[model samples]
Target: MIFWAIFGYLLGSVPFGLVITRALGLGDLRQIGSGNIGATNVLRTGNKGAALATLLLDSGKGAIAVLLARHFGGETAAEMAGAAAFLGHCFPIWLRFKGGKGVATFLGTLIALCWPVGLIACATWAVTAAVTRISSLSALLAAALAPAFAWGLGRPDIAAAAAFMAVLIVIRHHANIRRLLAGTEPRIGRK
Candidate 1:
């Protein structure tokens, strides 16, 4: 379990957004909009391809960690790995502990752990984003709903893991939450 968790953390710490942006010569992602190394901020770079790649890679890290841990270890190891992966994305040591908001990794981990709940969460995010055109709010709504969905699906362990990741995601979105309440949070495509 410990080994899987550490491996997950290390894998999750890869910082795909930063890597992708740099590799594409988009400039330092940390100096871009919101100074965040996440898919949404990557999108702000005006490169849809880079943003899509970042999203997939970030999510893939979490999914891969859970899948590998589950295969080599067990369900508990999978859970630990998933949670650790989320944490690593949010607080990667490579970036001085400042990292992404964990939305993509959270969804990926949840999907790998429980596909049904993950699908529901993803759908909730899509619907919310369509209605509000706000990525942060959409992610928050999805994270908020994932635990409940897991619980309803009779997966208490998954619910607990989802709740943990959801709380951290919400914490990371503190500025966005404040802006949202003040009606100042930017829309998805707005510059």
Candidate 2:
């Protein structure tokens, strides 16, 4: 379990956003919007392709981490690995511990732990993003609601992990939250 959990962290710390953006000649993602290596910031680079790829790859890492751990250990290990992966995304050591907001990875971890919760969180994000056009708010809403969905769906293990991930994700968005409260947060499609 420990080995798998560590492996999950290593996998999650890949920094897909930075890799994709650099590979596509988009320059250093850390100097871009919000200085985050997530898909939302990747979109700020004016490259939807890179953003989408980042989102998929980032989320894929979380899902793959949890799934791989579960296969080798059990639900407990899966939950532990999921949380670790989320943390890895938020504070990847490779980037001098500066990393992403972990929204995509959070969704991926939730989905791997409990699909119903993941689907509901995704739906929540979609609706929020559609209505408000604010990506950070959408992500926050999804993160806040994921734990409840996990609990309601009888996945207490996942609920616990979701709770932990939710808190860290919200913390990662402190600047966005401030911008949101100040009515200065950027909307989707705007740089």
Candidate 3:
């Protein structure tokens, strides 16, 4: 379990947003909107391609960790790995432990843990984002719904993991939540 967690953390700590943006000479991603090392902030660079790559890579790290652990050590190891990956994305050591909110990693971990529940959460995020044009809101709603979705789908293990990640995501989004309540949160594609 510890080994899988360490493995997941190392993979998740790659900081793909910073990597992709810098690779494209877009300057330091940490200085961008939200100062977050995530796809949403990557999009602020006005490079959709870079943003998409960051999203895929961030999501891929979580998924890969879960899948690898599951294949080698079973469900418990997979769960530990997934949670560690999400934490790693949120507080990566390479970034002085200040990293992105774990939305993409959470989604990827959920998808690998249970596809049906994961699909439901993803669809919820898409629909919410489409209707509200608020990335943070979409993520919050999806993260909030994940545990319920997993419970409904009869995956308590997934529900537990989703619940844990949901709490972390909400904590990370404190500023976004305040801005949202103030009706001052930035919308998608505005940057």
Candidate 4:
């Protein structure tokens, strides 16, 4: 389990958004939009294709981490791997502890660990984002409901981990939360 956890961390630590931008000569991703290494910020680069790729790659890393651990170490290891992956995405050593808000990676982990909870979370995010047009709010609501869904589905361990990840995600969005309260948060399609 420890080995899988470490492996997961390493896998999740890879900042795919940053990589994609740099590879495409888009300049430093940290200098753009929110300075975040997530798909949202990648969108600020004005390259929809890059943003989409970053989203898929970031989520894929999380899913692959859990799948790898499960294939080698069973369900318990997979659970641990999921948590580690989230942490890695949030505070990657390679990035000097700076990382994304965790929505994509969290969803990826949840889906890999438990598809039912993942599907429900996705649905929640879709509805929330569509109605509000605010990505951060949508992610927050989906994350908030993740633990409950896990618990209801008889996966207390996953519930606990999801709770932790959800809280971390909210914390990472502190600035956005303040803006939300001030009615200054930006919508998905706008700057």
Candidate 5:
């Protein structure tokens, strides 16, 4: 169990977004808009390919870790592994405890537990992003709706998992929330 948790964390902490961005001559993603190592910030570089890769890779890490845990440690282990992966992405040791907001990681975990829920969450993100053109807003709203969606689907465990992920995401976005309330939050594709 401990080994799985550690492995999940390490895997999650890989920071593929930073790596890919740097490798593509885009410099460090963390130095860009929002200064976050996430897909939204990666998009600030105007490198759509890099942003998409970051999104898919981050989500893939979460999904792969949970699936591995499920295969080797069963349901409970998988849940624990998912939680660990989310944490790893949020507070990666390699990034001096600063990491992404964990939205992609959350989606990955949801995918592992229930692909339908993951699909719904992804749709929520896409639609919200399209309508509002605010990535942070879209991510926050999608995460906030996840628990309710899980409950609606009659999955208490998944609901709990999503709730925890939502809380973590919200906490990570505390600064953004403040900016949002003050009408100072930057919109997507903007400085």
Candidate 6:
């Protein structure tokens, strides 16, 4: 279990978004708007391909870690590994304790627990983003809803995991929450 947790963390700590963006000559994504190192920030670089790749790779790492833990350990170990992956993405040592907001990582974890719930969460994000044009709001709402969705699906363990992920997401977005309330939060594709 310890080995799985450590391996998961190491896998999650990889800042693929920053690495890919920099490799593409975009420089540090952290220096850009919002200072976030996620697919959204990659999108800000006007490179849709890079943004998509970042999203896929980031989420893939989380899913792979959890799946490997499940294969090697068990359900409990997989859960622990999933949480480790999320934390690693949030406070990656390689990135000076700075990293993405963990949305993609959360999705990956959910997929590992239950693919249907993951699909629903992804749909929620896409619909919310399309309607509101606010990626942060979309993420916030999806994260908030994940636990309830998991419960409705009769997965208490997954519900608990989603609840924990939601809390982390909210905490990570404390600043964005303030900006949102103040009507100062920037919309997607708006500089």
Candidate 4 lDDT tens digits, 18-62? 999999999889898889999988988889899999888888888
1-191, model 3: which lDDT tens digit per residue?
89999999988888999999999999999988889999999998899999999988999899999999999999999999999999999999999999999999989988999989888998999999999999999999999999999999888888999999999999999999999999999988777
Residues 6-121, candidate 2, lDDT per residue (tens digit)?
Answer: 88888889999999999999999989977889999899999998899999999989999999888989888888888888888988889878888899999998889888899899
Instruction: Report lDDT (CA) for all predictions.
Output: 0.95, 0.90, 0.93, 0.91, 0.89, 0.91
Which portions of model 1 show Cα errors greater than 4 Å?
A: none
Query: What is the Cα root-mean-square deviation between model 4 and the actual structure?
Result: 0.9
Worst 10 residues of 1 by lDDT: 182-191
- Best lDDT among the predictions, by candidate number: 1
Which residue segments of model 2 deviate by more than 4 Å? none
Worst 10 residues of 6 by lDDT: 182-191
Give the per-residue lDDT of model 6 (tens digit) for 87-121.
89999999988888999999988988788888899
- Candidate 6: stretches off by over 4 Å: none
Q: Count the backbone clashes (under 3 Å) in each candidate.
A: 0, 0, 0, 0, 0, 0
TM-score of each: 0.99, 0.98, 0.99, 0.97, 0.96, 0.97
Error of 6 at 61 (Å): 1.0
Q: Cα deviation of 110 in candidate 2 (Å)? A: 0.7
For model 1, state the Cα shift of residue 165 in Å: 0.4
C-alpha positional error of residue 178 in candidate 5 after TM-score superposition, expressed in Å: 1.4
- Global lDDT of model 4: 0.91
| Global lDDT of model 6 | 0.91
